[model samples]
Target: MSVCKHIRNQGYSQREFLVLRRWAIYPHPSVPHYTNKLFTHHELQHSDYLSQLCIGYRHILFWARWVVTVIWRCIFCAYHKLFGRKYTPLPPIEDLALVQSATTLAEWIRRGKRSAESVVRAYIHRIQTVNATLNALVDERFAAALEEAREVDHRLASLTKQEREALADSHPLLGVPFTCKDNIKLTDMNHTGGIVSRRGIKAEQDAVVVARLRMAGAVPLGVSNVPELAMWCETSCTMYGRTNNPYDVTRTPGGSSGGEAALLSSCGTALSIGTDVGGSIRIPSFCCGTFGHKPTSGWVSLEGAGLFPDALNDSFGIQVVGPMCRCARDLTLALQVMAPHAAKDLASKVQHTDLRDLKFWWCEGLDTPLCSPLDPALRHALTAATHYLSTTFEAPLEKLEWPRDMSIATLMWNNKLRDDYRGQPPMTVDMTNRKGRVSLLAEGLRWLCGRGRFTFPLLMMATFQKLLAVNEDPQDSPHYWKPMQEFLMGTLGKTGVLLLPTLPQLAFLHHEFVPNMLDFGHTCIFNTTEMPVTAVPLGLSKDRLPLGLQVVVSPGQDHISLAVAQALEDKFGGWVSPVPVTV
Candidate 1:
């Protein structure tokens, strides 16, 4: 048998075999290069002594390479820890226009207190000045937005005072500049979801929500960035790149709506539309210290949101399109514009439950291993939020125990999502090879060598999906989900709200989220249960990073969550502008 035959028999590919041969024959100059010609020659392929020597050399090289790689990673991490840029103290905000909520901005524009063009220009100038450091806006329609703003001015000017009042009542968001998550289609903008391959793919028409917002007289400024396929909890991709938290440029803004959250945090846009299935909207809101809402499933249409094929079925009645904004009032305004049919009935019927009449349940943390212990700051924030609500509303707060089977329930929901892509191309990893199936070990090695193109979190999700795909039913298990859903709904029925931690910690440093992915369970659980949740900012931490809590209510009770969020916002200064960090 020849050396090539030996490698083939050992299950190594021709390419891999050749590479190994080269490495063994030409070992690093600093290391001993095995100079035995017999080891390289086919003539000695069958010789037991030479074969054993070659095997031993290969093993030694493998271990040596791994050790060196580990050492390099350690050094890289250490260097970043020492020299990486962090967020600096923010300057006092002098521009009241920048901090004004969408509702207030619209009111000003409608009342002739501010011109539409001026408001739009102020945001454009701010975005231009800070976007270089934040990288929040992936696409800008500034020129078009300005033109639209001018048109809005002309329209308002043409109307009499009585007509303007009527228009304001009808078009509440009129002339307000807002943004859309890149995944939420805005006609002619890239709907890339931060995937390099999807760049330049423009939406032919606005998404349902986008269309409605446009009709409501709001000008679309542009689209924001997201993680690839909108998969991770941190915003980054090879296309538009990573978005930094305006509060701390070194920390993540969270994802897949991270860019929108960062933009809102920086006051680049007063209100933005984002989608959430597994906490995409709320997590970013928490990280950026902005308000976000995930409406009851099916409240907002998913049309024109660039989801993966067949995702609608898997995530049916689970994912939703909602709003992220600087103020909770804007959430109700945006939701009304986006989901008018549902909002009309829900908004009118949504009587504000007095704090005295409302029941409050708080869970400091989850019972599952998937969740990390809450950061001390986050715990304090939650506690403070609870106390404020309790004292102000005179609402009694009780500790609620998380379901012991919550982890498995989450997994079962995810398993159903995975089945949607069953015969499609694998998302991040290529499991199929010319030889046969590729091992995850080999793929991981390829990733370490910089040969893999996928991001680490994406690869991890792909691996998870592949593992869960086995023996997983395409249909969701009602046995697991039904009872869980019923229990959650029953607990929060009518006038009850659940206060839960939005995330285990504040926005992590970029690339630091790979290990902390499991902590996402904090938000994802509500998604699984199809509950409406409002992510309410609890002001900045002592370190100036954002802290927050999730206000969860039963399905169709979006107004309940939003109301709670507003009360919290009023008590705790909401959405403080991050002190701009120099890149």
Candidate 2:
């Protein structure tokens, strides 16, 4: 295949590859374990094992031919870049008049000061005004939202004083407006999930996450866009288009939670839900200035979602449903309602988790299989953040040694991805394709390597670990796999949270990834590790885009991370609203 055809069949170019890499698709400088030597694809040329597994490249050839047919389309983009109209201006932050903190937003509805109808309508208007430029909401339910809001208002009007208070007190999220990943099911919305083939499938029942959100009295505004099957980081799907960052329309909002992040950044919804199998939630939250929580596995239900749901095996431990919002407290609020609980008893009494006595283990490096090099601004921001945390909290942050066996985790995650793929239909692998070759052979090597020590099932399970991959972003290098829990637990004593940069860089132009090699640097490691990570926006980068910090708590220790987030927010106003007078 010609280079262009080869690139086209990849569904993206080397430029696209670099773009995805920078957006956390591959290793970067921050992830210390990601060595350039390992990514040297030439090393794989000698693997006889790979030659044995090569398969037909017909489909790739077809896509390549199609790509060649459409190569001229690039001229349109080039013409536009050179002389076409500039981007549409973002709504001036000043245009925003009514601002609601997560706390105040909920309180307004509870106090009957702002009817759900009005609140939802206001958001609908905001989405209407902004979504054209952002492509944030894949499908909107304005009519249904209004009806639901009206019903909520009417119910409030008819309730007795005690009844109203009881009802209000019951659903903290009552009358609040929210949205979720299109991969997630809602009653009327088509659950496209950015996959064209799945674009027309209407959900018969709400996904467990949606059901929980609605049962808390929240109205679903609509479904947000996501990546194709949420496979890539930047949220561009052939079906719904790309979701832009609120900070810079030219930049990606990050995915597979990009749409939700964009919506949250624009204040289009009070709260939203997103799934994270491999940094899907955290990366978007990092890209768009927002607070997102990836709760511990099984803390929230993933029963009805479609984006890579099969990956969650009976013993699978990497995926989760989490909240995305603009404030730290909002995350806490969302988590309470979202935690696995009956709809009637959604109130979370798990508050007051103090941070004063918390122990923290700060991991400064990217700690992935990629070299996660941070932008200078991101580095400065992170340095400032570390200084503030150590100085203000009077808590000396200790730096932990880098784990050596991190690739073990990446290998495990590769196996998980392979198993997930195999569990699905048509288990065909044309290993002739570079991507397939890497996935299949890497998984096989892991399985074969461990056969001496494990049973068939156990060996397979061991092949795909929930461990942190340190050698490279699992998606980038054939060798990018690692398992590091034994090391982490050994060093950190299995307590306190691990603090790191949410990403190595601030948001960049949409195609910046074209030139960079960094891939899902920090976030994917956690996905592989199956650890709970909370991403909180720290402040804007020098370039004016958002910078976020991540806190990784021991599995099931999400509460501790939230406490730290809350404390950090208090110290450094988390998720600062842009000067809210949008033009």
TM-score of each: 0.80, 0.74
Residue-level lDDT of model 2, residues 277-332, one tens digit each, is: 77889888988888898887677877777644454442455677899988777776
- Residue-level lDDT tens digits of model 1 in 1-583: 3344544575554444554453333221222221222134443434555444444555565456446445544664686679976543334454678889899999899899999999999888878877888888988889999999999999999889888888766888999999998988888888776655565878788888899999999999999988878888999876787788887777789999999998888878888899887889998999999999998888788888864534444247567889999888888888888888888745444445456778899987564444445678988888898888898889878887543324454564574354434455565432221124445666678779987545667767778866755554544342234445565776678889999888776777777666556667778777777788999998888988998999999988787887788788889988877863333
TM-score (C-alpha, index-matched) for candidate 1: 0.80
Error of 2 at 188 (Å): 2.0
Off by over 4 Å in 2: 1-85, 93-98, 307-315, 341-351, 367-372, 405-412, 419-422, 425-483, 514-518
Q: What does candidate 2 score on TM?
A: 0.74
Model 2 CA RMSD to the hidden true structure, in angstroms:
13.6
Question: How many steric clashes between backbone atoms does each model show?
Answer: 1, 54
The root-mean-square deviation over C-alpha atoms between each candidate and the true structure, in angstroms, is: 15.8, 13.6
Q: Candidate 2: global Cα-lDDT?
A: 0.65
> Highest lDDT, which number?
1
